[model samples]
Target: MQHRFLLGTRKGLFVVERTVHGWRSLPPHFPGLQIPAVLTDPRDGAWYAVVHHGHFGTKLHRSADSGRTWTEIASPAFPPKPADAPDIRCPMRGVTIPWSVELAWCLEAGGDDQTGRLWCGTVPGGLFKSDDHGDSWSLVTGLWNRPERAKWFGGGYDYPGIHSILVDPRDPTRLGVGVSCGGYWVSEDDGATWANRSDGMRAAYLPPDQADDPDTQDPHRISRCLAEPDVLWCQHHNGIFRSTDDGLSWKAVPPPEPSGFGFAVAAHPIDPETALFAPAEADVCRIPKAGRFVLTRTRDGGKGFETLTRGLPLDEAYDLVYRHGIDTDATGNRVAVGSTSGGVWVSEDGGDGWMPLPVRFPPVLTVRFV
Candidate 1:
């Protein structure tokens, strides 16, 4: 297993390390803060944490020394609402979407050539970009100004949020985005413009006739194969989907057994055909199937999947993995699983077996192997 992994939890940020003795936790950094998003930018070896302070609003912190030291940086924010701008109501809750940052849902760095470039997705359906290493951020108004945003409602949040951003490795300008209840979008011109490209992903949560509407699909999460950026895996609200042509069109794959409803999915670093999913019940029942903790892996795209349960719980386990709760190292052999139930586990040899890191964390939201 890798020597270290970062844990972003409901209560704070923790850097878990493996030592000669055992798993050693460097003192918790944001002790009482809620870390909603984290990013270990491979571009510059810097760590970024997006924290939420109930009354203080959302803030961004960067650690350049591998969690040893930290610095406060400017967080993503929306410009003041124009007095003449029309008020928009959330389609799901019928409440006006606030022109403020509710939560920083995701963080991703730009391509290797684009240093100091970062992307952030937030609740209320806004995308922000930073050009000076978090010194300042500007909302990507292209996506925010889209009319489809009015059709986008919440997934788990009251207002819709963008949780996944895929920066294509081949071309820094090419991008793929995943939103809860807002459908999939792609931009080939570096986010200056966008297009809804979720052609085949169906949303069983909607009326049968409108289930395939591209503008209202709810994709729980999406992962892109680093080795094959054209291939993308989507864990949708209805089922699992795959795209072989840069997310232009999606194909429904065999939903992994026990269930296909899950939020977390991990793609192999080197293999486009390989991926893993954390299975759960359905929308109302989000726990593991029959209280048995397991993960489904497919090495042959989505043609087939195998259940893995060697070192996971089998009875009375009720861990629910969030969209960003599971992650894979560069090699893809080392995998990490963090759950909302406060349990974290690692698998050194793919999904063969697991080793539980001895720590009681506050609901783990995101796990990143740095």
Candidate 2:
């Protein structure tokens, strides 16, 4: 399949396509603006971009003509804290968790059965659902109102955020969310109720006695297989984990080469036992291991990994792929990855090899195939 990409970068959002002559980039949208999240609705070809303003806060924009123009829409907002509600504080920074949206970290379209529906995951751990496209949004209190949220502290940011939202293909009401330092949560009634499901995910950052606590485990990113809905893969803070039962529980995959300590995991579209990862130095050092950047793929459910580095930086490399920086096309044959260093690469054969894309860019925050 011909591949097109939506690269949400620190400077703006870019739409690029692979064509007969060469890869071509369309005029960028929201130039020089930090676009942290973006979504291209497969349902109607509508595109959505989330912009973060240094002084004005977060905003959402939608484009129906493929980025030719955009219209601003309502961004997600936390309901005013109840007048009598108890104070909730962040454990990491020792600050009160504000009832506001700092950033819209991720966005996804609802299943086909739910027309005009959209799901937006925001920082401060709020999930918002929109029924009229981006016209309006209502906070999903099922996951938010849980008492466990009080313990959800920051992982990399001062406030915890929900960066991954997985909607089951077979059941529209069944949703899975991945929160940094908040653990994984599942809802079965369309965001009316939720259950923490990060059992077996370890947290090395915590004391040994609390290392296995489900409520505090940080999942850098979680992705489900498009062809096998129940299977999911996670690149966690402490290590790599896999969920064979729709994320109700997880089992750590044996450590892969270089390191298993990075963000970005892409489950193969057709193979439940296959997925891709970008490994990096963890904790204090978040760059590529030993100054070499590479991609790892597992064909047998992480039993082992084969590192792919055909076109990647192998010396003095400092690229780090964010949680949303890598993606795979529907056929699982084409893969794309962007990094903090503004480097982009594409693999046309299941990551067997890669080639750099011809473009200079700002740090890429998120990349999604369109």
Candidate 3:
């Protein structure tokens, strides 16, 4: 079977197909909108894309017949400001938190049998749920009303966002979400309620006393081991983390080498012990360490990591991989990565080797294999 890739880019979305001969890039889809997230639901072959338009706002599109056509669906939005609701304030910074729905930062489909269920994470840090595909959405008020939200801050944007959503394949009601600067949260009874699972995680920017504060921990990205749903991995702002009991608690994993900061993390589909990360310089720099592009892989959970750079640029190359810009196939042997510089690479035999897909599209935001 030919491996297919759906690349969400800053300018649009592109589909790249890989066969025995090599990789081929197909035409772009949703030509001018910035696509921050895209997902092709294998259960029913439904495609969903999150489009961000600077002038108009964020919108969701659904494609029933692959990417050949699409239909605009109800975009997720914040509830109307309550007349008696008080202004949100940031407890740590002593400032009023600007509350508004900016964009859909992440899109995740529900379980294989739950066709109409969809979960979306948005800027200003709100989680929304849709039971009819993308037709309409309702704010997950349980999480939105959490008291800890007063402490969540933005890591890169003006406000924090739920950029990673993981729906446990074994239970349709179980869900996990990773927020930038807000940390991690897990729900056992669907979106009815959430619990902060940032314990043991650290935030370097904070003082020593507040380093382990759950609300202050910034998780750049989080992924779960497909073969072992209880095992979770996170590329944290300060370092890497892993959780064996779902997201109840996280343990810091020694970051591999040059720098520990990064925004993307991926787990092998069939191996709970294997994971991938693209380390970059500190947040201030946001560039590859030493100007070299390399991917660090860990075969024994986070015990140790090996830097893979066989076919990657060695010098003067600074490519940043976003939180959703890396993914692996079902076999766990095929991995694909897209960078902010529009660079795309694939590793066929795990992370031991690599090959570049002959296409430089827009600044890549997310990449997925179907």
Task: Please tell me which model should have the higher TM-score, number 1 or number 2.
Answer: 2
Misplaced by over 4 Å in model 2 are: none
For model 1, residues 46-142, the per-residue Cα lDDT tens digits are 9999989988988999999988788999988899988987888986668998888899999999989998999999998899999899999999999
Provide the TM-score for each candidate, comma-separated: 0.97, 0.98, 0.97
Question: Could you tell me which 10 consecutive residues in candidate 1 have the lowest summed lDDT?
Answer: 18-27
Q: List where candidate 3 sits over 4 angstroms from the true fold.
A: 91-96
Q: Give the number of the best model, judged by TM-score.
A: 2
lDDT of 3 by residue, 1-370 (tens): 2289899999998988875688888889988789998888877889999999989999899999988899999999888878876777665566666566788999888887776899999988999999899899999999999988888887767777899999998997999899887889989999898999888898879988888889878899999998899999999988899999898888999879767788899988788999999989877888998899999999998899899889988788889998998998888788899999999998888878889877777999999987
Worst 10 residues of 2 by lDDT: 19-28
Q: What lDDT does candidate 3 reach at residue 107?
A: 88
